[model samples]
Target chain A: MPCRMTSLHQLLASVLMMAGLVGPAAAEDPNGARRKALHNMVVQDCGSCHGLTFKGGLGSPLLPDDLEGVDDSTIATIVLDGVPGTPMPPWRGLVSESEALWIARGLKAGVFQ
Target chain B: MNLLRGLTVLIATAVWCLTAAADTALRGTGDLGVIIERADGSACIISTTERAILSCVDGLGDLSHASAVFSPDQRYAYIFGRDGGLTKLDLLERKIAKRVIQGGNSIGGAISDDGTLVAVSNYKPGGVKVFDATTLEQIADIPATYGSEGKLSKTVGLVDAPGRRFVFTLYDAGEIWMADFSKPGAPAITKLGTAGKLPYDALITGDGRHYIAGLFGEDGLAHVDLWAEEPVIERILDGYGKDDPAMPVYKMPHLEGWALAGDKFILPAVGHPELLALDAVTFKEAGRVKVHSQPVFAIARPDGRQVWVNFAHPKNDTVQVVDVPSLKVVHEFKPGPAVLHMEFTPRGHEVWVSVRDADRVDIYDARSFEKRGELSLRKPSGIFFAARATRTGL
Candidate 1:
């Protein structure tokens, strides 16, 4: 069972790496618990203003279709810096750059949808 | 022939017994309430007396930031959804009596003093829409237009006031307006004047005498005395938290849960791990208590002896209880991950807390702080009791 689990993890890691969704640092801990924490933050914290379904609320809609034209880097920057003159607060210290990118990719991919 | 008659009688008796079991005995809803299951877009009708969920009503859309208001009779609940859905839920039947997509995106709602109208605050179209409580028909639409450009501003902090009036603030416009429905169809709007920069949410005193709005862009809160002949917006605690370096706020502090403890108002300070106390009479800074983190809700128990506080995200696992008399932290404990909201029983004996991530609602003895019971739910957020029907600005 241990050997089979190792092969499955490798297969999943390779697919994620090929998709350019993870950095080298994140790859070192592919199935880390921090990933689960980050996912919860996106759903609960970010979802507080942006709708839970990402349709729209006080914050703008963040659905996959809504973010179609936006790039992952821009999304990551917004996640870190937040939009000025609004209730969106910066998450620089709370979320790392790579994690923000991961969240951005997940958002655009409708992983949270 | 005798055998066939016996069989028919037995089947009829069994069917009657099954029907009787399906329909429980009629009971009062005074000890009943609703909990918003945010993730599933549904609400659970809970019995506070029994500390259990009676039924779950589904199909309410986008309950991410949902809130509810009860009718004068306390038999119906008006649930305001983030997707601009207003659902009128019947407590006895445990179903959505009527639902309507009133706007594109909505914040919250309030019911008229006479229970004739329900008003929704919208963000997409940026206005307030009033509807008939029973029929769910549009009564009037008041746009939150401000400035020289006549731009529409998003409305927040919508609450019902005495004499069939609704009070709310414009987020982008920095103003508060009161819609008086004395004439029913024609609403007499009174601009209460400038609130601060980005007046996010507001609350009216239990006596319905004062309306206070918390500012996001500034330090102080905007205050208005509703009892005055000509209500004017006054700024209080205008220079609060100016000495400390600003911290990034993960969750905005909600003012609707502002607590009135004894002679003071215990309010959660934005971007600060503190609860600010103001003299309820003079509106001056009375005292401040350092809490665990940025407080999301500082709610006082019914008798106003203790105030319970919950923090924002990441630090939200902890809840602290403050003694109103000494203005000190009396107790602190971790219920579970993601403690979204807390509601005290009408008499302030027991408090029901919603642990979202844990999918459970834990009931605690308000005085002893003992865990009394628990009910499993799905991502519960807000717990509104039928007792709110009697309060001024629940």
Candidate 2:
């Protein structure tokens, strides 16, 4: 435990250093007009666990086929309240109500493209 | 070259269709024995067909898609709406005498051998509805231990024992119910929790002490010793994998089409898509063999020598015959649509099946296993005959 803790501290130090180098520039990076804004935020945040493209590297993929008949309101509830007995967690406290709806709309429309 | 290839493919398809059409040769021996279907508030027996009979919509009234029970004497048919309504009809009069609202979807009912009491499993809310066979009066409505929300597919098989006693399968709570209707008021239903997944249906042995249940949710069979204080259960064959983490096929090994053959039970396995034989007393896996792909139901002859099953593909939505002794599929009958549920008429010549998706129950000739005719319904699911054939003819 002692040796593993030392190495984990080193890994955290390196991650912090990397974040310092790149963090300031990304804060104000405006989402492209072509893409919905909230959808871009979801790609950046949710992609932390789900893959960036949402094709699911660490978490399950939110594929178009998977979201087949799912609508915006259901997605909003899934995003805000989270599905019980699943890996999804409530994003309501951290995210604004408008952000959730925007992301859900984009999820539906993006599947078409 | 492309044009030539397309022409070849077209020619092949034409030949295949022609050959398939020829294979739909209707074959079977037996006529309509007795019919049971849902009526206004109960089950009714409006008509009988010796050859192949169809449900006459004009006369039977709003009795589409009901569970019909025929009397042992073949004089009356009890009809009920599996959705909560039960009824009794005089076979000769073709009119409903009594009707009552019954709750439970996928609910099943059974009549005593002497035709005095009829009990139905209220599947959704988890209760049993007992009625007087002669007058079609509600005698009792007994519920199970923990309350069950009437959302899942419950109340499937209500098998009758002598003295107005019976067993029922609960879909979600993972239990089978034992109840005796000799009581006047609320019939007390004892929970026989054969703790596995949900048990879809069951077949009681001739003596009615032991029960073999088709264990859903897993690749196995649940053998319950119903005579004991708590049913002694032996779980065999758990085949569902973990890839389906949520909404898994836990309760949908979905094997149906079972019948008791002598001291052995014959059932299809959804995992293996094959028929299995287990000892009624010992609960040991006796025989395992294949019959159809995604086979759902089966009906056996009283002799247990032959069994018929529903098998489908776009090519053959039909009934396949199995020689139970050999456990081999020997014949096929092309009935319209998919055969969801079936029961052999007492006459032995016919097997009536509810074409679930097609919204009708088609009738077939038993011996040849061929489509004799059908009964049109809105969306029928369960089926049963009044009694075993009184006199045999096709």
Candidate 3:
């Protein structure tokens, strides 16, 4: 009975790791300090062109409803690469791909607003 | 006899006290200014001489990109807010005299040469609205409609010009317009022709003879000699940055703060970490000074002896001072994280810098390069003094 129980526990651990729920790589969420810095950048730097409330100013509105039809990856790509021939500039150097993706998801979820 | 003497002394003392109170009530606003508390949506009325915040007035909504212009008498400040709030603040009363929501999104504003009209540039509905300076009542609305499609263009860089005119650039239409309010209610709008690609911001010379707009979509600037018989837009410094690979611009360079040091105009190069010097006479490139990362505001001292440059994000913490004659950076220092603005005292003896992250405004001696004093406040930006009342296009 003890041997059977140990085998079941091993199977559960493998499943969790495969799902990226419990792994070293999945733990790379921007730590607390880094997250705070990113939050400030969104409110202060991004808020310069986009209204602080994300209602829209020089830049388009960034509210969740405003970004309704756009997918997360598309938003992330625009955040990283920027739209051409516009005032929007790329953030490739300032933010990592994963971090940009995180920001994109957050924006879609109204987490930043 | 003793009672009579005591009453006489009391009367004299009362008269003296009354005189002192009257003098205090008549204090001048020459040394007073307001600093925008961006995060708190308030402004601190400060005294340059005392180096202290006198009073804070709130309820001026969404000051993320606020700018102000002083009345001719320098007693009232017309504040333009990002969320379309135009507030008339009474400096003497230390309170908001009037507030009005003029548009959906406003960029900035300008006071008329006569100080009778206040004009604002809007982005959302895309137009310029002029208001009665005293009553805060809408007088005229000039839509920035352009192209065959009749699309409204975002108006930027509105400045008060001589002859009771307001000059501004249309971002989407790539054109400049001058609204002459000489006739008051009926403004004569003149299409000043194409300003290359996207004219983001502009500045008028201290003499108000030249209007120069910086282009964003291309590496050039649009210049208009307002004194010309038939003023025409001329592209200057076209393709100046073609040789260099473009870098991401975290913040757009502010042309309103373009420096006029000596005979050269010190301007922040778009998307590059350099300050381009243009001859104030011919408007030709004279030199370039490479400095810390992407320069935002390159403002000259009031005496035009030194130019101070501040940078954009990542490098935004630093400030560099360049001596005009040598075109060389003389001093570099970090005021603190997120140094948003620098305002020189009316005489240029000292500079007040707003350190946003630190929630403090630091005063430094312009010549000695030493810290003078600091005042704690909320996240502050854009420090404007009453001295702007006499200057052109602050």
Best by TM-score: 1
Candidates' chain B TM-scores in the order shown: 0.94, 0.70, 0.94
Taken over the whole model, the C-alpha lDDT of each candidate is 0.89, 0.54, 0.88
Q: For all the predictions, what are the DockQ values? A: 0.61, 0.02, 0.56
Taking all chains together, each candidate's TM-score versus the true structure is: 0.91, 0.59, 0.90
Full ranking by DockQ: 1, 3, 2
Model 3 lDDT tens row, A29-107: 4666887898788888888888777778888888767887897779889989998899888989899887777677556
- The segments of candidate 3 whose C-alpha lies over 4 angstroms from its true place after superposition are A1-26, B1-24
How should the candidates be ordered by lDDT, best one leading? Answer: 1, 3, 2
lDDT of 2 at B336: 59
User: Residue B255 in candidate 3 has what lDDT?
Assistant: 84
DockQ computed for model 3 against the true two-chain complex using alpha carbons: 0.56
* Tens-digit per-residue lDDT, B84-148, candidate 1: 99999999899999999999899988888788999999998998999999999999999999999
Identify the superior model by lDDT, candidate 2 or candidate 3: 3
Q: Write the per-residue lDDT of candidate 2 for residues B79-159, one digit (tens) a residue.
A: 554345565655444356566666633244667755777777654455677778887677776665454453433454567
lDDT of 1 at B366: 98
Kept native contacts, fraction for each prediction:
0.84, 0.00, 0.72
Indicate the TM-score of model 1: 0.91
